[model samples]
Target chain A: MKLFQDKISSAASRVRIALALKGLDVEREAIGILGPDALNRKPEYLQLNPQGLVPALLTDEGVLLTQSLAIIEYLDERYPEPPLLPGKLEDRAFARTVALAIAADIHPLLPPRVTAHLGMIGVKAEDIAEWSRHWIRVGLTAVEELLARRQTGQYVAGDAPSMADICLFPQAINAERAGLPLDQWPRIAAVVARLREIPAFADNGPAPRS
Target chain B: MKLFQDKISSAASRVRIALALKGLDVEREAIGILGPDALNRKPEYLQLNPQGLVPALLTDEGVLLTQSLAIIEYLDERYPEPPLLPGKLEDRAFARTVALAIAADIHPLLPPRVTAHLGMIGVKAEDIAEWSRHWIRVGLTAVEELLARRQTGQYVAGDAPSMADICLFPQAINAERAGLPLDQWPRIAAVVARLREIPAFADNGPAPRS
Candidate 1:
């Protein structure tokens, strides 16, 4: 099994944290998603992941799978020793739903493609950053409200960090990087702080964007 | 089971198709996601789903679940006889990856929040529409490339429609509704045409945006 990842990728980092939490070892290669190597844009890489996105996991069966959530869920299902999803059906649904809040709603908006589009349309870099800040704050605010509910505990789901925490931690790092203050959401700040201390989540720290 | 959905919601339409495919008899409540009813914005609705998004499904166990894809996956998992995901682990991952290309990459940008943000910044309606069209086309182009690969069958994955088809069909409808042309991606257009002919996907047609 092998995983092609760019350390700086928000989606790739989610996979790294989940792998660490699961204590699963696989061959890892850091490929540039957008720079000189830009391996992700190559035809060969595109053959594996047609979307040309970072973090494509080739399972033991040799099937190349794209999508961070899908790959992480695959890992969890394959290696059940430390399941990332809750055992109870409802709890599992909750974990996944909140995870989607970040993965689906927030992260996609801040990718290079969107930023590049903003630039092409004459949006200044600072203005682009402002745009990022706005979307990140709005998405995180939704997460904060969800976390304020009784369902969120030490982690985003139960005592343990499930898919919810795995997905949220990277985005929280992104929020901080984008200069969006987290003070507005104390509950989220608390959860992120706790998550950062975990060896699994911390081992694959967010790589500074070059 | 009860589902709170908006007729015009792309995400909600995904669940509607999936539920119909599973043949689950779910009680439906049509809530305005944008107008005065904007049930998703109400405090009571927020209590049920902190994200305040449409298509929140309350399970028989009374657990409220959000995120259209998550809700559909839950339905698929619970009702496994006619699985929305492939039986093979690898196949399931592929289906999910293509599905995320739409759910994560495409759908979020066209949501009211993003468009509303554009308007807040003095972006004209035409500019916003152009922005939405550009993103949708880029995302669909990626999907089209993936579908062009030999791996894709009659549907996005196999002959029968899986999660990938279910998610892609709704977004294709949205693209067309938004005045984006699909001729550029013949493979995707063909698959979408086949999917729309299916009873499950056809039952919930796209409602004109108010």
Candidate 2:
């Protein structure tokens, strides 16, 4: 198995943590997305992922998985020893709700395209920052609501580290990188710090790409 | 079970068909998204779905599942008499590959905010059209590639009305709504047309909501 990844990508980091949690050994290659190589746009890489996106995993059976969520689910299914999801259906649903909150709402707005496009629309940088802060706050508020309803365990899904924790960690890392205010989102920030203390999450995360 | 949905959204329509296929009775409320009683912005609705998005499901057990894909999967699991996923894992992954191509990628880019924001940037409408078409063509090409590899049957999966068909039906309808040329995407169009012939895909679909 092999993984074509970007060290700085939140999506790639999600999968890296999964692999580490699962104890799977995948041949890893880091593609410098912004450098001269432009490896992600290369023909060979595009063949692996038509979307030309990072964090494409090549399974030993030769199937390539694209979406980070799908790939992580696949990993969990194939290796169920240390599960990434809760057992009960409702618990699974709760965990997925938290994950999708990040994937669908928060992450989509983070890419530079969103802010850069707003800049072209006569929206000032301050306006963009406010918009970013507003949405992140909305997402964190929803996450807080979810957390409040659950038992305060060691992880997002009860005491075990599940997919919800996997999803939240990267977004928290990116939120700090984006300079979104963390003071107001203490519950979420606390979860972030808690996740980092776990060896699997801390060790598997990608080193900063220079 | 009940579905809170609007008549115009393809995402909502996709869930409608899933419910219809499962032969489940769901209390249907047609929300007027632009009216005085817009269900989406209501505090109660927001409490149920903090994302303030449409197509939120109130399951029989009273749990609210917000994301469309997540809702569909929950229904599939709870009502397994008629499966909405393929038998094999590879085929299931292929179904998801097709589904997310539209759900995550194409549908997101086609939203009005995306084009309107681009228009604000002095981007020509033609360029925005080209950009929309670029993603459409790319996504369709990947679907075609997956189709070419799989055995042709009644649907994107073996011979069943699975999530892939459920996802594609709405997306193809939305593509037409977006006015993208279909001639260049014959295989995808063929699958779209074939799936529509099934009553579950046709009758339950969102009629063009302009």
TM-score of each: 0.92, 0.86
DockQ of each: 0.66, 0.35
Model 2 docking category:
acceptable
After superposition of all CA atoms, the RMSD between model 1 and the true structure is 2.3
lDDT of 1 by residue, B36-129 (tens): 4454456877667766778888888877778888898788878886888877677777788888989998888888768877777667788888
Expressed as tens digits, the lDDT of each residue in A1-210 for candidate 1 is: 888898889899999888999888889977776654465456777667666787888877777777899898788878897889988777788898889999998888888777877777667788788888888887888888777764656888888999899888888888887777677788888888999799998878668686
Model 2 complex DockQ against the native: 0.35
DockQ, candidate 1, comes to 0.66
Clashing pairs in 2: none
| Top model number, DockQ | 1
In Å, candidate 1's interface RMSD is 1.5
* Model 1 bad stretches (over 4 Å): A34-44, A150-152, B35-43, B150-152
Question: What lDDT is obtained when candidate 2 is compared to the true structure?
Answer: 0.73
